[model samples]
Target: MMLSCKEATRLMSMQMDRELSMGERLQLALHLTACAGCRNFRKQIGFLRTVTRKFGDQIDDS
Candidate 1:
C-alpha cells in the first residue's frame, strides 16, 4: 500500500533519528527520492535539525 504524506513524514523523522529498522529506512529512502513533496519535507526536517542543534546549545547555557 502507498503511504500517505503524514505517514511518510513520520517515517522520515524516524529515519532521521536512526530509529527505523534497516528495511523501513530503505523504504523511506526510496519514497523520498521518488516524491518531490516528501523530498522537500525531508529537506525541511534536516534544516530544522541543524537550526535546533545550533540554537539548542545556547539554550542549554542560559
Candidate 2:
C-alpha cells in the first residue's frame, strides 16, 4: 500500500528520531519515488539535521 504525503512526511520526521520498520521504510520509499514534494521535504529535513548537528558540535567545542 502507498502512503499519503502526510503519512510519508510524518515517517520522514520520525526517521530522524528512531529507526523505521521495514514496512514503514518501504512505504515511505515508494511514496518518495513518485512524489517530488515529499522527496524535497526529505532532503530539506536532512539538510537541516546536518546543520543542526554541526551547530551543536561547535557549541560543545566552545
By TM-score, the best candidate is 2
* Model 1: CA > 4 A from native: 56-62
lDDT of 1 by residue, 1-62 (tens): 56677888999887776778887777777777679999999899899989988995677644
Every candidate's CA RMSD: 2.9, 2.7
Native-to-model Cα distance after best TM-score fit, residue 2 in candidate 1, in Å? 2.6
In model 2, residue pairs whose N, Cα or C atoms come closer than 3 Å (at least 3 residues apart or on different chains), thus clashing, are none
Candidate 2 lDDT over 1-62, as tens digits, reads: 78999999999999999999999999998898899999999999999989987996677644
Q: After superposition, how far is residue 3 of candidate 1 from its true place, in Å?
A: 2.1
Candidate 2 residues lying further than 4 Å off, grouped into runs, are 56-62
